[model samples]
Target: MKKNYFILLFILIITSQACGVSVKYSFTGTNLDPRVKSVQIDYFPNNAVLVEPSLSQTFTTNFRDLFLTQANLDLVDSGGDLQFEGEITGYKINPMTATAEQTAAQNRLTITVNVRFYNNIVEDDNFERNFSHYYDYDADTQLIGSALDDAFEEIIERISQDIFNASVAKW
Candidate 1:
């Protein structure tokens, strides 16, 4: 019985291979089309009322890096199979938790990015959407230096992942 089971499994594997049955998976959860060979990431400008000096550059580079590391696609200046362009629409800080003394115990910083994606290989995959995320910090910690950097990193990471999912991930 044991030998029969092994033989049956072997036969199944061989039959599947012969029939060209296969599955592809990506660790990054991207299900990009095979025709997508390259990506073009346009500059992400900060158009928010409260702009961070390094936000534009940081976001653009990080967004491109995600494609660079995860996708087997070239980064092109133009005429890419996939394209992305967007602007920072909102950057606002609001008080979160208030202390007993009527002071802000915590504050939240939220950043919103408006994204437009183009898929040359599949026009139906194109989309435009807004991605937003927030980071909370102690009210005593000013939004400068490392505090600001941490906030940027957290928010950017979430937005980048959301954009990635929207563009290529089917789930």
Candidate 2:
């Protein structure tokens, strides 16, 4: 009887502790305040010196998709509880490494976006900054076809995630 009584007490204590924990946990690791309900993201035009025709559209779509998939917040057209506005500011190709012949061995493709985030509920949380990401490929290979596509995909994914973390995730 004493053993059963102790087990019951232990279970009760654990349940009570769980109830006292107020944080609402989700798979995306966002601890969004309860008052925030909606988000807005403006079209991010590519203003880079070297513009990829589809980059703006692809990035804008991906940026919006991240919030939609990861957070429970509704996407609003304007004046949302949280907002994101940005433009691609830089795109460059640079040689990263040299080969035995003193020529380029690897080249890096980099993209940068200037982001402005607004959090109406918490004014102090808003920020404007640049986020950049890059991918490196063999110098001999031209950045075209599948290679170029893959580089864009990788860089865009990273930049979008960084933006999401900064504006919403607070990471």
Candidate 3:
């Protein structure tokens, strides 16, 4: 019995070592490479028709925070291995018509962010892409303002995840 237990323990240790864990992801033809050591993310400017007073700052700060938490790269003001900059290119809210009553019953808010990224360490790896997401709330809700604020939070979360996946996760 003791011999069997020792064998099981040894096998478990070997199998765990063979699992091939890695912090960096690998993609065959993706622009993301693991050579990057640092990143610079400039403040995202807002160019949308409907301006939320703090939307730009919120977006920029959120993006930075997301990267800091998700990726292993360090943040730098200049001379970084990677760099990104862009703007909030679009924001819109439109009424959604309810099919049951043939009337508007809710509003859909959509926000779009366009980012341009360059990998200075890897000359061939560069990306420019636009990522957008939307959220909706009932028209009858008295706290429409708060609902919109929540929508923006969700949108930013998605955008941050998308950017991180594109830049590091190789998706």
Give candidate 2's TM-score.
0.84
For model 1, residues 37-118, the per-residue Cα lDDT tens digits are 8999999999999988899999999999988988778999999999999999999999999999999999999999999999
Q: By TM-score, is 2 or 3 better?
A: 2
Query: What overall lDDT, based on C-alpha atoms, would model 2 receive against the true structure?
Result: 0.89
**Candidate 1 pairs with clashing backbones:** none
lDDT string, candidate 2, 43-158, tens digits: 99999999999889989988888889998889999989999998999999999999899999999999999999998987888999999999999999989889988998999999
Choose 1 or 2, whichever is better by TM-score.
1
TM-scores, each model vs. reference: 0.87, 0.84, 0.76
Model 3 over residues 12-70: C-alpha lDDT tens digits? 99887834432345332224445677889998989999888788998999999987876
| Model 2 ranges with Cα > 4 A deviation | 1-25
Candidate topping lDDT: 1
Ranking by lDDT: 1, 2, 3
